[model samples]
Structures are given as C-alpha cells and as structure tokens.
Target: MKMIVGKGSCGIAAGANKVSDSAEQYIKDNNLDIDVSVTGCIGMCYLEPIVDFIRDDGTKTTYVLVNAENIKEIIDSELKGETLTKYEMPEVDKQRLEKQTRIALRNCGVINPEHIEEYIAKGGYKAIEKCVTEMTPEEVIEEIKVSGLAGRGGAGFPTWFKWNAARSAQGTKKYTICNADEGDPGAFMDRAVLEGDPHAVLEGMLIGAYAMGSDEGVIYVRAEYPLAIVRLNIAIKQAEEKGFLGDNIFGSNFSFRIRIKAGAGAFVCGEETALIASLEGERGMPRLKPPFPANKGYWQKPSNINNVETYANVAWIILNGGKAFSAMGTPNSKGTKVFALTGKIKKGGLVEIPMGATVKDVIFDIGGGIKEDRAFKAVQMGGPSGGCIPADLVDTLIDYKTLAATGAIMGSGGMVVMDETTCMVDMARFFLDFTCKESCGKCIHCRLGTKRMLEILTRITDGEGKDGDIELLESLALNIKSSALCGLGQTAPNPVLTTIRYFRNEYEDHIYKKKCTAHQCKNLVSYTIDADKCKGCTLCARNCPVGAISGTVKNPHVIDTDKCIKCGKCLSSCNFGAVIVD
Candidate 1:
C-alpha cells in the first residue's frame, strides 16, 4: 500500500505534516509494507490534510481532515482492509473535483512534487522532450498558436505570439521568465502550482526556453512564498541531476538553465515591465512598452515572459496537442483558468474551470455557495485591480471578453466572494486603500489621482462626504486609467468604478443618508440598547470600553450614543439581546 499526504502549504497548515509523521511512524512500528509520501494541494483546501491511501490492487481511499491520531486509526483500518466512512471524503467535495477541468492542477494532488520518478511516471517532462526532440522550435510555436492559449497572467496576450516574437527577435542572446510573482491580494493559484507541482512549471519553462531559442530561464517568484522558493530550488537541482536543465538536454543541441530570483513582494511587479525592472535590480515599476519584453527584455536581450499558470498550461497543451485545448473555452479565450476562492466563501480554496463556465457554477455549485448560507450579494473578482461583480451577473459567462465587459478583468483569477453583509462602499474603499498604498508613484496621475480618490472614498464611508464627491471620484478614475504608466495604476480604480456603477445606491446612502445599509462602516453606525430585551446584569456596562452604557443595576441599560465608538463590545458581552446596531 502507498499512502500519500497532501503536504502543500495549506495541507501543512492544516496538520498534514503531523499526520504524515504519525502514518510513517505507525507503518515503521507495525512493519507494514507501505510507502508514505507527499503531494501538493489538490485545490480541495477545505478538506485539507487530505490523505490518499492506494491499495496494492490500485484502489484509492481519500481521507479528509486527517490528524496524527485519526491518521493512525485510518492506517489501522487500511491494514484490516476495512473502510472508515467517518473520515471518507464527502460527496460534495468529490463532485467539486469532478466538476473542475483541471489542466494546470492535473498533477497537483496526485504525484509527489519532490520526486522526479513520480513526475516522470505521470508523463512530466514529455512536453519538453517533445519540443526538443520531436518538433522544431517553429513547430512548437505553431502548436501553441493552434492551441489558442493566451497568457494566463491577466492580459490574455497570445502565449505563442510572445514566444514567436522572442524567437524571431534579432538578438545575440534571449531569455525565458516565469512570472511566479503572484501578488494579487487574495490569489494563490501560482503559489499552489509552484509548491505542489514545481517540476511542471520548470518543464513548461524548459519548453518555452527551447521554443524561444533561449539558454537561460528565471522564475521570479515572491519571497513571501518560502515553500515555493524552497521547492523550486529543489526541483531545479533534481532536474540538473537528471540532465534536464543543464547544457544539451535530452541529447539535443538545445541548452537551458533556470535560477530563482525571489521578489520583494511588490504588487506592481506582477506587470511585465515592472517585473523586468525588478529583475534588473531596480525599483519594481513599469516602463513604456514597444520594446515589449520580447523585443528587448532582461538586460536588453530578447525575452519571453509568462506567468506561472500560463507556463503550467504549456506541458499539457504540447502533449495533448493545441487543438485539444482550443476545443475547450470560447473563441477568444481557450482552455481552463484557475482562480483562488476567498472572502465570505464556504468552499474557499482554488477553483479551475473552462473559459465558458458561468460565475454561478463556480460560486454556487463548486464553491458551495456563500458561508452560513447567507444571501450572495456580490463577488469581487480580479482583486483590487478587478471589480466587484454584483449578484445579478452571477450567470455571466467567465470568459475574458465577457468579464471585461462587466468592468472587471479576469486578473490572474482572484474571485473573492462577498456576502450581503459586505458593505459595497467599504469594499471599494478597502480595495482603493490597497492600491493607493501599493502605487509605485511612477506616474503622477496614478499616485495623486488614486490618493485623491481614496480620500473621497474615505469621506463617503465616514459619513463626511459632500456633494460632487462621486463625480470627483469618477473623474479621477478616468484620468488615472487614461494616463497611468502601468497596468497596476490603470486598473487601480476598478473596484471603485465597478461599485459605483453597480451599487451606486450604497454610496448614496453612506454620503446622503449618513447610513451604511450593511452597517459595516463603524463611523456611520451606532449601538443602542433595546429596552424590551435588556436584563441589565451590568455586563454591557462592564464590557463597554468607553463607558458608553449607563443605568441602575438590574435595570434596562441605555447606550450613550455620543460616547459609543461602535465597537460592539457591549453587544457581544450582553447575555441578553439588548444591544442593537443601527
């Protein structure tokens, strides 16, 4: 029997390491003929610490939420050839797995990410071998073009177009870069890929380097992703040992090598120009395009840049043939896209779907709807740079053109689900605040305009907004979008713009009525004592940090509205349902 524990970052955080330790110790002590190993995340994060037991007959049993103690029990059951239904993976999770079209995540939860043998057994380096051995660079480029795979890193630029440009560029030297610097606020698709399936990403880069006739590759991953960095280092060393990364790989004249460049966690570096600038040891800021990376990138040599997800799709496309992938999504956008599900979501984790799938299917069917079964209000797609898609557009087909039409770009697939209690105005404010701080200050319009817009949003949320603030925000957003030097500043106001477009009433309520309908903005809400429900055990008064509640002992306490900070301490402390927020 073989026991594999999901030991990606999420799995480790959920105690997969402990489970693995216990399972290994148990197997050793009992002298069982079982091998224990680890794999990366499967995107089923909610059922983390997932343990997969493969019997000698090749049947597999998946156990969810396994810990040190329960894992021993599960191992004992496996030894006895008995099934433990209690720890079995739920049907809903199985359905979720069956629902995803998984291309990038194909080997994530299945293979040992650190083992080359396991990866090769699953057809790991075949794509690069096919590229270097079977097909010419031009043939490889044509195959990618036929597959119609665009850059999965938000811009949706043709992957083949970039490679061809780099391939055709008249330069003595060329380079290939994987933009693993995934800095989106709630996105982790890249991190998961890097951690769970490092070799796949490396293989993709190898093929890209070969296609572009480059001898060097670099993975510009975020330093915050220590696990990914560690794993990438390990994978590179492993590939080098196997003669896959060094000079003349697979007996072909093509020679390529990859090194890691850990980024300083700048969100702006997600942009290609900015990433290149950072790679050159400069400020992570964007420069004017037209040199366009392919023409002159990375020390002014021809370069091809694709994000982690984009490169991840390469091996699959090459092996399966481009037409096989192009057969999937819409005309403009082809193949499956991976998204990070977060914020007020029940089944919050990684989500992968074909281009034509609707938002409804992901958020409701796959995501298991909102947390606590709350009313789904809006989904903040694309992170701070993306927009807040309202519930009305839940059925919107999740294609590049379609999502763009909704005022949100499918930015590297960050789908933050929001519930009814989420204040749209505050949500916009929150995203704006992130952009304002993250602004590299390269462009005057973005630096000052976003700050100005943020100030107005702050005023609106604080119940201090005046007339024309809305108009002022819209005007600033337009100017910033038109004049900002980079994609970061250009799309900084997207959340604000989308909220104003779809939930203008919420803005008006905060500005005109001095009320937040969702009651999220503390400055616009106050706590009051409900006389009918107050038992007055002095708990409210004792808990009020600012002495906001005052009354005789055993009498119905009243809240001093002027003194209240809207902290809701009294509300939580009161045994009786006395404190009310309004």
Candidate 2:
C-alpha cells in the first residue's frame, strides 16, 4: 500500500507537515506496511493537506482536509483497508479539468521536487534533448512563434518576437533571464511553480537559450521566497550533475549555465529593466528603454527575460508541439493561466483555468463562492496596480483584451474577491495607500499625482470630501497614467478609476450625505446604545475601554459620544444587542 500527502505552500500552511509527521509516527507505532511520500499542491487549496491512499487492489482513495489529528484515523482506517465515513470524497468535474491546459504547471504537484530522477521519469528534459539534437535555433524560434505563446508576466508580449530579437542581435554573448521576482501582494502562483517544479523552469530556460542563441542564464528570484530558491538551487545542481546545464549538455554542442540572483524583495524588480539593473548589482529601478532588453540588455548585451510561469510552459510547448498547446485557450491567448485566488473567497488557493473561462465560473463553481455566503460586491484582478471589476461583469471571459477593456490589466494573475461589507470608496482608498507607499518617486507626475489622489480618496472616506474632489481625482489619475515613466505608475490609477466607474453611488453618498452605507468608514460611523434593548446591564459600560458607555446596574445604558472611541467593544459586550454602530 502507498500513501501520498500534499506538501505545497498552501498545504504546509494548512498543517500538512504535522499530518505527515503524525502519520509516520502512527505507522511506526502500528507496524503498518505502507509507503508514505510527499507530493505538491493538488490545487484544491481550500481542503489542503490532501491525503491519497493506494490499496493493494490498485484502487486509489483521496481524502481532503486531513490534519494532524486525522492522521490517526487515516492510519486506523485506510491503512487497514477500512473506509472512514467522516471524510467525504471530492467530486471530479472533467470539464473543470479539461478547461485547464497545464503546460507550465504540468509537473508541479506530480513529482518530488528534490529528486532529479523523478523529474527525468516524467519526461522533463526531453524537450531540451530534442532541441539540442533535432531542431536548429531558427526552427525552435519558429515553433514558438507558431504556437502563439505570449509572456505570462503581466504584459502579453509575444514570446517568439522576444526570442527572435535576441537571436538576431549582433552580440557574441547573449543572456537569458527568468524573472521570478513575483512581488505582487496576494500572488503566489510563480512561487508555487518554482518551489513545486523547479526543473520545468530550468528546462524551459535551456530551450529558450537554445532558441535565442544564448550561453548564460540567470534566475532573478526574490530572497523572501526561501523555499522556491532552495528548490531552484537543488534543481540547478542536479541538472549540472546530469550534464543538462554545463558545456556539451546532453551530448551536444549547445552549452548553457544558469545562476541564481537573489532580489531584495523590490516590487519594481518584476519589471524587465529593473530586473536587469538588479542582476547587474545596481539599484532596482527601471531605466529608459530606447534600446530594449532584446537590443542591448544586461551588461549592454542582447538579453531575453520571461517570468517563471512562462519558462515552465516552454518545455511543454516543445514536447506537445504548437497545435496541441494552441488548441486549449482562445485564438489570441493560447494557454491556461495560473492565478492566486484569494480574499473573501470560500475556496482560496491556486487555480489554473483556461484564458476564456468566465469570471463568474471561477468565483462560483471553482472558488465555491464567497465565504460566509456574503453578497459578492466586486473582484479585484491583477494587484494593487489592477482595478476592481463590478459584479455585473462577472460573466465576462477572463482574457487579456476583456480584462483590459475594464481598465484592469491581466497582471500576474492575482484575483482577490470582495463582498458586500467592502466599501468601494474605501477599497479604492486602500489600494491608493499601497501604491503611494510603493511609488519609486522616479517621475514627478506619479510621485505627486498618486499622493494627491490618495489624499482625495482619504478625504472622501473620512466624510470630508468637497464637491470637486471626484473631478480632481479623475484629473490626477489621468495625468499620472499619461505622464508616468513606467507600467507601475501608468497602472497605479486603475483602482481609483475603476471604482469610480463601477461604484460611483458609494462615492456620491459619502460626498453628498456624509454617510458610509457599508459602515466601513470608521470616522463616519457613530456608536450608540439602544435604551430598550439595554436591559439595565452595565456590561457595555464595564467593557468600554474609554469609559464611553454610562450606566448603573438595573438601569438603561447611554453612550457618551464625546468619549466614545468607536472600537465596537460595547457592541460585543451587550448580550441583548443593545449597542449598534450607525
């Protein structure tokens, strides 16, 4: 009998390590004959620490939400060929699985990341072998061009065009870079791929090197992703030992070597120019690009850079051919995208869906809808730089063009769901706050413009907005979008602009009525005690940290507005629901 447990990031976060340890201890104590192993994320991150048991009869049973306590039960039941009725089986939908074309994440949770042979067993380096032996540099580039694979790192630049530019450049020593500096908040898709399947990325880079006529490659990963960096380092060493990375790799003249360069967790390093600067041991700032990276990049030589997920897809493209890879997604966007679905979502985790899948399908069917059955308000795609899409557009297909049309770019695939409790005005203000702090201050328009927009949004949320504040915000957003130096500044206004487009009523109510409809604006909310519901209890008065509630035993309570701190402690303390915030 064999048993496998998920040990991916989400799984670990859900206590998969504790479960595995306990299961092993239980097996030892019971003297059970079972093979226990660790795998990666199975994608259903909501029910993580998933355990799979293979019986002697060759039947496989998967158990979801397995924790440390459940290990004893699993050992007592599955290990002894007894079924546990407590754990329900997850239903598999072929449509959901078929919608995703897992080229980039093919081997993510399927193999042990630390073992080189497991990667080899899964046909890992076969693409590089074929590229080195059978295909010429021009043929490889042509194949990628025909495949219609675009960059997955925010901008949908054609991958083949980048390769051809670098290949045709007049440079003896070209460089290839994998931009693993995934700094987007609430985004862990790239980190999952790098940690769970490092070899796939390495293979993709090798193929990319062969296609672009590059000799050296660097993986610019952030230092914060310690697990991913460790796995990548192990994979690099394994590849070198197997003659896949060094000179005459796999018994061919093509030679490529890769090195890991740790980023200092700068969000701007995800940009190509900033990445190149950091790789060159300089400040991680975007430089002016007349001579793009393809023309004169990295130490002033032709270089090509792609995200971790993009590189992970290359080996699959080479193996499966262009048509097979192209058939899965929309005509223009020919691949499945991995997204870190989070925030207010019931089933928040890593989800891989086709390019044309509707946002509603993802949020409802896949994500199992919002947590606590809250009314869906909006979904924030992309990151802080992205926009909030209204619920009416939930049926919109999640393609690059469609998302772009809604003032949101298909950024590094970070989808955060929001519910009715969320105030759009406050949401916009929160994102502005993030962008204002993250602004590099490289350009005058972005530096001054973001600060001004944030100020206006703050004023609106605080019920201090004047008549023309909205107009001022719109004007500042336009100026920042138009005059900013890079993508960071250009897209920083997306949250403010999109919120105004979809939830203007909320903004108007705040400005005109001086009210926060969602009760999210702390300054606009007033704490009060209901005399009838008070029941003469001094609980509210006793629990009030600032002594705002005034009452005696067996007497009705009253709130002192001047002394109230608006912390809502009285609301929780009153058993009869006497205290309320309006």
Candidate 3:
C-alpha cells in the first residue's frame, strides 16, 4: 500500500509538509512497509493537507485536513481495517469535484509532477509524438480549428486563427509563448496547473510549436510564483532528458526549444505585446495594433501567444479529436474553463466547469453558497479588466457573448463572490484603484481618466461626494474605454462602468443620501452601544485600539463617537453583540 500527500502551494500553506515528514518518521520508527509519495492540489483547498491512501487492491480513499497531530491515528486506523470517518473527505467536498468537468486540470491532483514516468504512463507527450510522426502541421491546426478553442487568457479569440496567422506570416523565424503572468487578484488557475501538471503545459506548447512552425518558445511567468517556476524548470529538464525537447524529436526534422522568462509582476504584462517587451528585457508595456504580435512580435519575428489555460487544452483536444471538445459548451464558447473561485465564498479554491453553466451553478451549487449564510450581493467576474455581476443576474450563462452582454468579460477566469456586507460602490473603487496603479501611462485617457474616476470614488466613499459626481464618472469611463491604446487601458473602466450600470442606487445613496447601505464605508458608518445587550464586561473598551469606549465593570458602556476610528473592534470583541453599526 502507498500514501500520497498533496504538496501544492495551498496544501503547503495548510501544513502538508509537516504531515508528510511526520508520517515518514512514524513509518521509520514502526518498521512499516508503507510507501509515501506526493501529488499536487486536487482543487479542494478548503480542506487541504489532503492525503490519499491507495490499497494494494487499487481502491483509494482520501482524507482531508490531515496534520502531524492526527497522522498516527489515521495510519493506525487504516492498518487495523477500521475507518475514521472524521478524517475522511466530506461528501459535500467530493460532490463539488464530481459536479464539474476537468480538462485543463485532468492530471493535476492525480500524478506525481516531478516524475516523468508517471506523466508518460497517463498519456503525456503522445499528442506531440503524433504530430511529429504522422500528422502534418496543417492537420494539427485543422483539428484545433474544429475544436472551437479560443484563447483562455481573456480575449476569446480563435486559437486556430492565431496559430494560422503565425504559420502564414512572412518571417524567417517564429516564436510560441505561454502567458503565465497571471496578475489577477483572485486568480491562481495557471499557478496550480504549472505546479501540478507542468508536463501537460509543456506538451501542449510542443504541439503548438509544431503547428505554428516555431522552433523557439518562452514562458513569461511572474516571479511571485516561485514554486510554479521551479516545477516548470524541472519538467523542462525531464522532457529534454527523454528527448521530448531540443533538436529533432522522434528522429524527425521538427526541432524546438523553450525557456523561462520571469516577469516583475506588472499586471500590464498580461497583454501579449507587453509580455513580449518584457521578454525582450524591456519595460513591460503594450504596443499598438495593426502590426499585431503574429506579424511582428519578439524582435520583429512572427509569434503566437496563448495563456496557460489555453495551451493546457491543446493536447487534450488533439488526442480526443476537436469535435469531442466542441460538443461540450455553448455554440460560442466550447469545452470547459478553469476558474479561481474566491472572495466571500465558502468552498473557495479552483473550480473547472463547462461553459454555459450559470453563475448560480458555480457559486451556490458548486461553491456551496456564500460564507456565514449571508445574502449574495454580487460577483466580480474576470479581474480588474472584467466587471461586477449583480445577484439578480445569477442565472446568467457563463459564455463569452453572454457575460459580455452583462458588461463583464470572461477574463482569465477570476470569480470573486461578494456577500451582502460588500458595498458595491466601494468594490468599484477598489478595482479602479488597482487599475489606476497598474496603468502603463502610455495612453493619456487611461492614465488621467482612471485617476479622475478614482478620486471621485474616494471622495464619495469618504462622505465628501457632491452633485454630478456620478455623471462625471460615467463620462470619464466612456471616454477612457474609447481612447485607450491597449486592452489594459481599454478595459480599465470596467468595474466603475459595471457598478454604475448594475448598482447605480448604491452610488446615489453614497452621493445624495450620504449613506453607505452595506455599512462598509467607515466614514458613513458610526459605532454605538446597545444598552439592553451590553454586559459592561470592559471587553469592548479594552479591545478598542483608540480607547473610544468608556464604562465601569457591570455598567452599560458608552462610545465616544468622535474618538472612535470606526474599526469595528467593539462589535467583534463584545460577547453579547452589544455594539452596532449605524
């Protein structure tokens, strides 16, 4: 029998390493014959530090939240032929994985990423071998075209079109790049795949390089993902040792090579041109269109770029045939998409679901609804480039055209759920703040227009808003969207525009009534003590950092409103819930 522990970044953060070490020590001391191994995250990060037990009979059982303290008990229980229900993964979490289709993340949690043998055993590198030995470059591109696969980075442009463009472009040399510089706030889908299944991404890129007739490649990943970078480097070396990379693979004339370029975490580098600039050792910024990347990219050579998720689906599509993938989702958006489900959510982690699935299906059905049983308010789809989707539109289908109709893009798949406690006005301001700081200042409209909008939002949230502020914001957003140079600048106003479109009332309340409905803006909220509920235990007074509350023991406390910093310390410290926000 063998045990496999999850060592993904999430699992490591939750102390999986300690559990692995402890289990190894226990086995050494007891002279048990059990073998231990490691795998990547399984997407159930909420119950992390997971351990899977594989019996000799080939049956597998998973245990969640395993740690050093309980590893012995679990091992002992398993050895005695007894079941420990508490340690087992809950059925609800299992159902979360069951209700979805996993394509890009197929081998993520199942295989040992460091071992090429494991990946080869699971049909890795076969697609590229097929391309090199039997299929022609045109045949490979045709299969992708039939699959209806688009760029999964943000823009849903046809994958076949880009590959075809690079193949047909007039250039002596060409390049293939994977945009792994995922800078979205709540997105980690790329990171998880890189750490869990690096070979899958490499294999997909190999197929793309063959199809596009590019002999050189680069993966522009952010330096923040050290684990992903390390694993990717390891996978690349292993592939090279196995003759999958470098000159003339499978004894064919198709020679290709790939290298890693670590980015400085600039959000604009997510754009293809900006990424190319960074890869060339220049400042990360976007260039003009017309001479798009396919024509003159990376030292004026033809180049094709796709994000990690896009490349991950390539091998799958080639192996299974494109029609098999095209049959899954809506007409416009085919196959499945990977999402980094986060923010005010109960089962927050990675989620992979088919296209056309409703927002409610992901949040309520798969995500297990809002945290603390709070009322769902809105969800921020995509990232700063995307827009907010209100709860009223929970049933909206998650397709490129449909989400675009609701003022949101299917950007890089970041689903940030918001509860009733989240203020829509403030949320818009938050995204605007991120976009404003990330702007490359190449476009005057995006640089100054986003700044002007952010200032107005700040004033409104701080209770200093004036008349016509909403109109001024709308005008600036529209102007910036039209005049910006690159996609980063063009979509910078998404959050502000989307909030104004869906939740105008919240903005009006902040501007006209001088009130924040969600009680999130501290300037518009005041803390007060409830006499009937206050036990006067001095917990609130002692916990208040500013010493704003005053009272003797056993007496009702009084809050000095002028001195209170609006930090909500009293409400959290009080046992009887005496503090209230007004």
In candidate 2, what residue range of length 10 has the lowest lDDT sum? 88-97
Judged by whole-model lDDT over C-alpha atoms, candidate 2 comes out at: 0.86
Clashes of each: 0, 0, 0
Which has the greatest lDDT?
3
Given candidate 1, what's the lDDT at residue 136?
96
Error of 1 at 192 (Å): 0.6
- Name the top TM-score candidate: 3
Per-candidate RMSD, Å: 1.4, 2.0, 1.1
> Would you list the clashing residue pairs of candidate 3?
none
lDDT per residue (tens digit) for residues 1-582 in model 3: 788999899999999999999999999999987899989878888999999988777878899999998998988888766668999998888888999899999999999999999999989999999999989999999999999999999999999999999999997699999999999998999999999999999999999999988999899998999999999999999999999999999999998888999999799999989899999999888888869899999988999999999999999999999999999999899999998899999999999999999999999999999999999999999899999999999999989999999999899999999988999989989999999999999999989989999999999999999999999998999899999989988998899899999999999999889899899999999899999999889999999999989999999999999999999988888899889897
In model 2, the clashing pairs are: none
Taken over the whole model, the C-alpha lDDT of each candidate is 0.91, 0.86, 0.93
lDDT of 3 at 22: 97
**Clashing residue pairs for model 1:** none
Cα TM-score per model: 0.98, 0.95, 0.98
By TM-score, highest first, what's the ranking? Answer: 3, 1, 2
